[model samples]
Target: MTFSHDPVEEVARALAASGLLLRGGFSLGEDEAAPAGLSGAPARSILLIGQAGPAPWPHFQRWRERQARDIANPLDSWSREVIGAVAKEFGARAVSPSDRPYLPFQQWAMRAEGLKPSPLGILMHPTYGLWHAYRGALLFENGLGLAEPHAAIHLCDTCVAKPCLKSCPVDAYSGQGFAHEICLGHVRGPHGATCRTAGCLDRNACPYGTNYRYPADVQAFHMAAFAGL
Candidate 1:
């Protein structure tokens, strides 16, 4: 089936309808090298796909429900399946963040989207605040002539209050870096119920993109997963 729109645009539209977005992409050449582990599926370029804010939450939830009826690991499996289908449509190979020998998604995200990290270590999207997430990427054997990535203004720089640093009850996030043990302990404790049911307090405290915040149920679902519940 031939598509009238640009291949990237066509894929982006399809992904958007499914609650995903083409975050960005890059060509693999002399200046931009492909990762070593990707030898099994070498590609001339890669397209990074991700979930922006709560847009994909409902779609993901519905998919999760349907997949849960039969699959033991619905979320991961569903992500792989959806991204794989998209890759197939474009004649590319699908890769996920959860895959072994991790593909340096964070680095790819930073390079592909020119994004910076938030206080919570999650990449702070210029418009999505701390609510966005990378799902997977598509690797194509040839360049798609994707647009070049330019640095985005780091939103955290202009915020004088820096509420995210102060919102965590256990001080899990700060300039010193995340205290993983403390954060985990708090999430597993009795007082962690609030966080476990509503998501990270620090993340929720971010002033930017408030309208894009995930629904409480979606946040709670992620919190539950983080707490290993």
Candidate 2:
């Protein structure tokens, strides 16, 4: 049966109905503005940022699984699949961030389509407190505007410790940027200890969305991927 709803609205509804809350359109724009990592030749895109459902920790954990693979994070595969199906319905291709040069895209991504970080963290919420990730994005052959743009908010400006930078024992995130080799070292090392035990060092540090914690097994799986395992 042909789906009968506005594509963007349907995407938003589908995401919410799936127990995932949509972030906003600007985030997608930000990612696009950033160095796209092989998004299969960007045309225009309809951005959607979403997070797993909640109330039950297990469900929340299940949702975050979409971040990586190896173990059993259903969310990782689940979301990509969901996005793929959705994009197909709308004549678009889902793009995983890994397909392109990530770091080079960071600065632009940090400031996609004119969306900037705000004090309420309007730009930061929706997913993994900066620690969470873009496993991939849906690239539409044509860009479509949402019903309306997300209102600006300032959640991050109030943040004091900025623990996202300092919380890491190994200092994986430089705050100004990332330290890849050092991060992968522990992720793929003999022990593969702390990170596996906790989660992403920088990711865990973010104060936003205290509820979006990924289960231990899920965390381990993602770290393993980072190690190229």
Q: Report every candidate's CA lDDT.
A: 0.83, 0.53
Cα lDDT tens digits, model 1, 1-229, are 2558788888898798788999999887856666532345457778899987778777777887765365555667777888988878877788999989888899889989999998789998888888889999988776678777999989999999999999999999877899988998999998898898888899999999787898889888787667777
Per-residue lDDT, model 2, residue 44, is 53
Highest TM-score: give the candidate number.
1
Q: Please provide, for model 2 over 1-229, each residue's C-alpha lDDT reduced to its tens digit, 9 standing for 90 to 100.
A: 1347666577767555455544444323545453222245544544644454232235445565545545454545566666666666656565544444443223323433223453323246444444334434555545565444533344566678777777666776653556778877877676557787666766666777667666667667567656766
How many steric clashes between backbone atoms does each model show?
0, 19
Task: State each model's C-alpha RMSD to the native.
Answer: 2.3, 6.4
Query: Lowest-lDDT window of 10 residues in candidate 1?
Result: 33-42
lDDT, residue 142, candidate 1: 69
TM-score of each: 0.92, 0.62
Model 2 weakest 10-residue run by lDDT: 104-113
